[model samples]
Target: MKPPVLLTRDKFRESVFARDNHLCVLCGAPADDAHHIIERRLFQAPQEKGGYFVDNGASVCEPCHLRCEQTVVSCEEVRDACGIKRIVLPEHLYADQPYTKWGDPILANGQRIRGELFFDESVQKVLKQGKVLDLYTDLIRFPRTYHLPWSPGMNDDDKMMQSLAAFEGEEVVITTKWDGRNTTIYPDGRLHARSPDGRPHHSQAMVKSEAARFSFDIPPGWRVCGEDLYAKHSIAYDNLPSFFLGFQIWNERNECLSWDDTLEWFELLEINPVDVIWRGTFDEKTIRALPLPNPEGWEGYVLRLARSFSYGDYPRAVGKYVRADHNKLGVVHNWRTAKVTPNQLAEKS
Candidate 1:
């Protein structure tokens, strides 16, 4: 007899990878194999149903796939190794099974849908152990406020004055705006960039080393957000005091501490805060006349309110002012070329 067609293979694999952003759910690397979390052979039918379902699959790298297959590690261990809470399964699988791993229950054909589907104690145990640090959940995007030009026909000085209007009566602290890649430090000492595209950042080791240097504690579900200033972006920060500078501290709820509190935490951890430009509220004329923070004309300044604000809500508490004629050098054909080499200065010559 002719072999039964393997119709579900490619489609199921693609769907899993797509859901996982083509990265191994275990290590966040490029996935090459679709792992069956529940071995296909364990299902009742050999050729027909449960084996090909998407709920039982995970997109994994070669090494991780091997580890899953050899039984060297449990499925929960594999998920925790990468901080993945639960692998999302295809919605359709719940139709027949009524329940699947990582999903809520569905009512069978004639039964009334009475109570809500819930994870049993065993399932809850697995889920609690597999807490994943999701990108937005663990690492928050540092908010940026724009510089408002004075008016349609106003001069540069007038524009600067206009931008400072919002902070006229508020206590404001200004700091130099460093050009760098955004990074975050998790409570478990893991470091990651703010990228959603699955592209890896080169500063993981650097961040870890710097984090180790600090003696302070970060409570669970909190993270330290900073600027990874090792490389040159639009403007080269050649005189930067350090490779990384702590700018904000966020709790599990994604609320950012106010400027003063953030600085206090930075001091406690011995982490360098961004260079301060000015403190205290400034009059429009004073703001207009203030000198640029850097003689070389760095990007701009960040104005922050001195007190802490509620988490996850936008605050009119912070703003930035970028130099109109800031350096736009170092444009490259590809971003990989922007990495600062050890001998970048020598090579430039």
Candidate 2:
């Protein structure tokens, strides 16, 4: 089938804004720009039309537009907000089928899809060729945690609100959200900072070296996800239980272990789990009224379902509340080459 005739750039922007009633789909502010869910470069013939389909565009304010560029607002989210059912692509682009690259669907914005989207074809090919490591390593990386309903700066939406309403009666576990690097450790002893590059953060070596002190037989694709609090980011901790504090565990099947199982494994593996701030049925007021850190060390809290859930359910299963000014300070200070300030541990009695 032939693709629709391409509209000029200005027409595309005008049509999208008009369709959205000149309102930002993210925040309800006056629209200032048109956003493309999928990059133009990913299209078969980007230069010709720049993939400017109205369905692929969203009207957003400048703040939301910047968030989209930074990928804080995911493409799938924009599509859901704008009521775009499916990305319309030219017929030529269809030959690629489900995914443009292994582990990447053509519909996804880069690799930051809100849910589990596709399997890695490259990993499957390698596994078929007897490369077991490829399957294990690629399967166990940390998944991104979404913001809670009350988290500052989030765009209000029905899905998240629905998730919040459903969460009201369920037992939930809340833990202190430490300010540090998100690191993952494999049973094979490989450590990685939260990055696509599969390399540890420069400030993470001290934490990784400390983790090397313990050993365990974690099943092939199970991963220990944690925070590396060795180097100061925005918050400086004078007394920390450990450099690497285990938070979540993901198995080969991409299931997040129950809180009980995670705690049990942390104890069995001699790992320090993050402090449990509260554990009970969900309460919106209590969570909201919780006092902020007095001296500015504490970042915030994370709430998760007490039971196990699949990786794809992360958006509904877990949510985080970071301090209002945390992102601002985090951006001003570059942790990559920032001075490493060792957090002092409490003296053993």
Top lDDT hit? 2
Per-prediction tally of clashes:
1, 0
**CA RMSD of each candidate after superposition:** 17.2, 13.1
Residues 1-349, candidate 1: write the lDDT tens digits: 3432333877778776776788988778899987766544333223434456554567889887766654344555655554444443332222223332322222233221111111234433443444421101233334324353421222233312223444668776778776666777766676666522235656445666777676237778677878776666666644555678887887655567888788888887777888777787655566556787574535666666666654312224555666655534554436664564421222233
- Residues 1-349, candidate 2, lDDT per residue (tens digit)? 4545467789989999989999999999999998876554344333334767787789999888767654456566888899887665432232333332122332322332122423335334433443222222253335556677677734332122234754768888988888888887777677777643454556667876866765356778678888888877777777788888889988776788999999998988888998888888888898778765442766788899899987645656788886667766654265556667677776676
Q: What TM-score does each of the candidates earn?
A: 0.51, 0.61
TM-score of 1: 0.51
lDDT values, one for every candidate: 0.55, 0.67
Could you tell me how far off, in angstroms, the CA of residue 279 lies in candidate 1 after the best superposition? Answer: 0.9
Return the number of clashes found in candidate 2.
0
User: Lowest summed lDDT over 10 consecutive residues: which window, candidate 1?
Assistant: 110-119
lDDT of candidate 2 at residue 326, scale 0 to 100: 72
